[model samples]
Target chain A: MDAAAETTPLLSVRDLRVSFALDEGLVRAVDGTSFDVMPGQVLGVVGESGCGKSVTMRAILQLVERPGRITSGEIRFRRDGEIVDLARLPPRGPVMRDIRGGEIALIPQEPMAAFSPVHTVGEQIIEAILLHGHRWGEKKLSRKDARDITVGLFRDVGISMPSQRVDAYSWQLSGGLRQRAMIAMALSCKPRLLIADEPTTAIDVTTQAQVLALLRDLQAKYNTAIIFITHDLGVIAQMASYVVVMYLGRVMEQGPVDEIFHTPKHPYTQALLRSIPSMTGTTRVALPVISGALPHPFNRPAGCPFHPRCPDVMERCSKAVPSLRPVTPTQLASCFLHHDQAEPS
Target chain B: MSDTAASPLLEVRGLQKFFPITKGFFQRVVGHVRAVDGVDFTVNEGETLGLVGESGCGKTTASRCILRAVDPTGGSINYRTRDGRTVDLATLSPAELRPLRAEIQMIFQDPFGSLNPRMTLLDNVGEPLLVNGMSNRNERTARVAELLRVVGLRPEFMHRFPHAFSGGQRQRIGIARALATNPRLVVADEPVSALDVSVQAQVLNLLLELQSRLKLTFLFVAHDLSVVRHISDRIAVMYVGQLVELAPTDAIFNRPLHPYTAALMRAVPPADPRVRITDGILGGEVPSPAAPPSGCYFHPRCRFAEERCRVEAPALREVTSGRFSRCHFAGELSL
Candidate 1:
């Protein structure tokens, strides 16, 4: 991103590490990860399950659940020309409460689980606005105002019959409608950053396409920075400007979308790009798979986490972990092949 | 796909499965949800026929009906038996269906739920061999070991429990269990969907290789078109409870005759960034099966829907050679 140097990043994560204490051992879910989300930039985090993509996003929100907590990192968010470290804020503290819904919002993976089944969709969204209504910049925000805003957001997210649909309970609506409602709830407070975690994974493909299009439209209209986390590379191709490929909690590669897809330096990234079946992929031919399976959390490999499954693994990979470094002018990768780069992350 | 044009291994016609909605103290049936309403399709020998649809479209129910997991309300499932016998599976009594069970087996979607958690891999895979008249433990063990190796798993792991394996390994074990009876037809329901992309590829390639190696015919039911396009010889696109289009994989992907099929094609995000989705013709949700709209079930969401489509239901008819479509203006629309 040429424009990256011109302006400050909206959110900067430096060596973020999240760990879960289990009976087996300490599971390093997010191990020494760093990245930047520029203002209005769509940063795509792509990885398979247990790859720590969700943990990294949760770390940013300071919403790491029980048994898991951010071990060490600096999550610097640029708010009103000042950088505030989110890692320092308590999860339930006042600053986090404001930032959770007021500045940074999340469109969670499962809309059915996120929503309260008993409450009507409109009532819940209105409740969010009333709780953080001060961010609306209006002195006296009424329930009626919140209702109107909720209805408008419903319409903005492309829900049919917004007036009547708002009164329907989450269960009364179909999967697609419920997902739109979730997106509406996330954008209710005009959040500067939206963290969408596999928002379209549950819905039908046609509905998924519509949701992706709606998100793109909303992001453009609000210029809200978004961190789209999904395992689908096709979705990343459609929605992201920059891409981050993660494996076993560490960033395997990060670069412009085109570079990451075309000239992936990390063997893991290269193998991943080849493994998926695309719309235009050859039929019946065996996809070159990344051999072996993801290691158990308790048995995370020494040195490079992906060394066990990497196609181009080296002896150095087993002894020392490679730091994220520039492989090309525009791309950075963590591998022995690219360790010769001068600067290191 | 051995002699795929010669004969069909299974044929389903007018398959209908309805669940009643009971209400009040008396539990009076108010309405019926037509889950698999008058669906028809055929699978030839050694061919993978991809039965695909979104949720609530009855793909899973139809697959279940074939396995007799759930009894069908009405249908004729003419399945060719191993001994040159043809039988209507839908009408067969449970006692009669027991023997035919060896001919047809299912691979479930959720790897964790399908396999018994308490059972060891030996018991899980060998249970099928044991029940299918292989009572000798030594014989079952040898066969189970070979089956495990067939699906690319370590034979030694057969002694281990299901919890010890990863998602991909568990699915392989599931495949081994399904193939233990040496079934001719395998109905796999979203087998690879639960695994990661890399692991999903491994499983998919395994399925393809096993099909060709074992000469096994597959009724691959899934919502993913890309995977379907990769493994299936023919693709059947279902909407609501009926098939909207059925054609060869290439034809369905390249020149779909139904608007819904084209809509589904357009919905799949091409991995290339240049082919971004900015606009779509599909709108509205898939209609509730119990309360489907008049005429075509997909008209509400289809961009090519016309006045006739709103009042008159379309019949599945041959539009091109070996291609069937259910649209009033099939093959007429540019879609």
Candidate 2:
């Protein structure tokens, strides 16, 4: 609970480690991940499948399932000039419930399954609003007024014909409409923070673009800190102000969006950036890929997690884990090449 | 630049593939799924034709019909098989299509799912050879090794299982497997979509390099326009169960005729910060193929939809030289 750090970052995570205890042993899904999201700023967490980007966000929500727990770390949420330690809060207590869907709303990857199939989209949105609408008593407005407000929220999220579509079932709606409905539900709570996890992966390219643009516009209008997780760098380029590159349960690098995309310090981040198909007129000759497969959680590497696939691997890289350290004024990387290696110059 | 000046290597004329939607417990024929109502396109020799659309747009079904992997309800699929023999793929039986399978190989979307986990990389690549009654294990090993080398993988890795390789490498293995039979035409369904973005390029470059070296024709189907743009010589945009636009790579990218095509192009997020596309976004999802709206399937969500679009189904007609669009007012649309 650092007050001085609260001046800039709305949410600051430090040395966050999330592990799952299975029959095999402890599997570190998120190992010592740390980053900050300033208010009204969009931070893109980019990584491929099972890279722990989602795990890190789940850790913040304290929604990690059984056997998985935050071993050690600090997740501080700055509100009203006071830093609240999220990690210390009980998972299902009264204080936690107030913040879970109220202060921080989540737009999950798949919109179809995220909402209850039985409940109408409006009902779900109303439930979220009811939970967070503290100032309004149980009967702040009549049922009809609440319905009207829900429709308005839906319209704000760009869902067409909100009046009639409000009564429609989730299955009756198209993928795009369902996604917009999910956004409407998330925004209805008036959360200060929004966690969007691969919100566009399932939809078509055109719909994906619309949803991304909508998220950016909504983020600005709400002045909320957004934690955008996605596998697409093109999307991150369009939306993110800051970027955090994760690989095999660790933060490979973190920096400003431009710096991360143009001049990534970490080899993995650079490889990822180069991999994206560019519309920037830069002819993509074959992109460089990490040499080996990602190390699974069960077969965790002894030292640096990405050492097996690192192009600049050394004898020491396999023997010591590199801590997330500052590579530049605004850039941070966890690689032996950047840590204490011989200067190239 | 006349339409009839040159013939396409593989021409699909009014291709239709409909799955019977049985209702009764006795499996009564109640209705047809209309999976591929009527799709028409051509794949010129040695040219990569990119087939792009959202999921369930009949892209996969159309591919299956081309490869004779599935039966088509109607239409003539004129294609040139190996040994420079031209034949209609749709009418051929499995026994007669055996030789054609060697000529028109398919690389499936999921490398992990497509490959047999229990089998070695060498076996997976060499399966076609073995299946074709190549009893010599040593010959299969040599051929598989050469393919591995061609795909930029070391021969030693052939002994390893697919589970050991990265997604990109696994896709290379899939590509090598498809090429093992020396197929002239390869139908690659979302080949790079399964791999990591960085890995996708490696696989794409490998496919491109292989295409040129072997003088192979490709029918690359994918949902990602960016990947399709990089590799395809020509691109076809599909909506619902029909082709909305067909044009050359640059034509499709720069001057799309169909509204759907234009919207899809605009949807491609510009990699650079300077250029911003004016077309806002496609408003809604593609309508269901089972009950596609009358006339043009895209008319429901199309911004330029008009009275003609609601009543008369637009046929694929030449909008410009070497470009085709299916819209009531194809040229009139501002798109």
DockQ of the candidate models in sequence: 0.79, 0.48
Model 1 Cα lDDT, one tens digit per residue, B104-163: 999988898989989899999999888889999999999999999999998999888999
Candidate 1 lDDT, A86-191, residue by residue in tens: 9999899998999998899999999999999999999999999999998888687999999999999999999989999989999998888899999999999989
Model 1 chain A is weakest, by summed lDDT over 10 consecutive residues, at A336-345
- Chain B alone: TM-score in each candidate? 0.98, 0.95
> What's the TM for model 2?
0.90
Q: What docking class should model 1 receive?
A: medium
lDDT of 2 by residue, B225-268 (tens): 88888787789988888998999887777777898888887887
Q: Candidate 2 residues A1-345, lDDT tens each?
A: 355543588899988889999997888888888898887788899898878899888988899998999998899997677888899999898877888888888999999999889988888777777667762455666567668879998889888789999988899888888999999887776788899999999888988888888887788787888899998877887888889999878888999988887778998887666666654333224545556566666898877777787777789877777877899998999888887742121
Winner by TM-score: 1
Candidate 2 DockQ score?
0.48
